[model samples]
Target: MEEKPFLGLRTVIYAAPDLSATKAWYAKALAIEPYFDEPFYVGFNVGGYELGLIPDASIVEGSTVSYWGVADIDKVIQRFLNLGASIHTDIQDVGDGIKTASIKDPFGNVVGLIENPHFSL
Candidate 1:
């Protein structure tokens, strides 16, 4: 029997409303272009992590998971909306320079966006 090798987590898929526009917005906002992307799947290489955008307009209700601690919460909110994302929660200055927001993709999956005061890119 041969032994198997292990690597770190490769990708995480989040439902998207508009697949094409979402991929484009992420490219502009994160300054990282997805290496592998198609109509069904959108992938982005961000540092060591990968942001997977899944277009689930058929099943995804809206806002499936809330991805917090994003680099620029404000920018993400704006871009998502421009690309056809709906805001479930507006940007609020909670405290300690941490701004937060809850958004829904075009497919209706819920996503949370946030910015931390401590973490620096």
Candidate 2:
């Protein structure tokens, strides 16, 4: 039998105390509407990647980290900040010409961003 490479990221779920509010905020921030909505979960199709929001009464701060790909780290960081996301990790070169950063959205979810010159779709 031959081994197969793992499929790329498909979904990243974030806990939200107020699912409706969180969903609305994400819609505005991402400038896209959710394709899936339910009482328990809400999902947005972000360029084929899924951003999921689930109702969680016990949601905590910085519970999970999911990095999103970006063309320009600095510009994307500024855009996120402009959307009212606070810097959780400032942009920095990780190595191999890759840069990364993270931000805490208004709902306390950590949204990470990465810029890799070597990566391509």
Candidate 3:
């Protein structure tokens, strides 16, 4: 058997033009402070995964979406909405007891969430 070279999802970095404001928004949305904080970069540990933010003036909500695992899709979506995240994609049943959605963060990044019962660590 051959060992796969790829590991797994590690970090998702977003461009934060206003680092201080963006960092505060994420802290409220994720209900936690960033484990690593600096003027150049900020990293939050989301369920053992890294959600990083970097200072950049050019920011755009690109097509790529990185979905984070969630237990309750609706609840998480609503929470994000309350925290100023507009809906990038509505929740949809992707089959096999799986659901997914994406939201545009205040910093203009698409943040995705997934509820997959089949996925296991």
Which candidate gets the maximum lDDT versus the true structure? 3
Task: For residue 63, give model 2's deviation from the true position in Å.
Answer: 4.5
Ranking by lDDT: 3, 2, 1
Comparing candidate 1 with candidate 3, which one achieves the higher lDDT?
A: 3
Ranking by TM-score: 3, 2, 1
Candidate 2 lDDT (Cα, 0 to 1): 0.85
lDDT of 1 by residue, 1-121 (tens): 8776857446556766678877776677567798888888888876666778877755544425545567778787887788777889888988999888888766555667778878654
Model 3 RMSD vs true structure:
1.9
The predicted structure with the larger TM-score, 1 or 2, is 2
**Residue-wise C-alpha lDDT for candidate 3, range 44-104, written one tens digit per residue:** 9988899999886454345368899999999999999898999999999999999999999
Please report, as a residue range, the 10-residue window in candidate 3 with the lowest summed lDDT.
Answer: 56-65
Candidate 1 RMSD computed on C-alpha atoms after optimal superposition onto the true structure:
5.7
lDDT for each of the candidates? 0.73, 0.85, 0.90
lDDT of 1 at 20: 80
Q: Worst lDDT window (10 residues) for model 2?
A: 56-65
Of the candidates shown, which would achieve the greatest TM-score relative to the real structure? 3
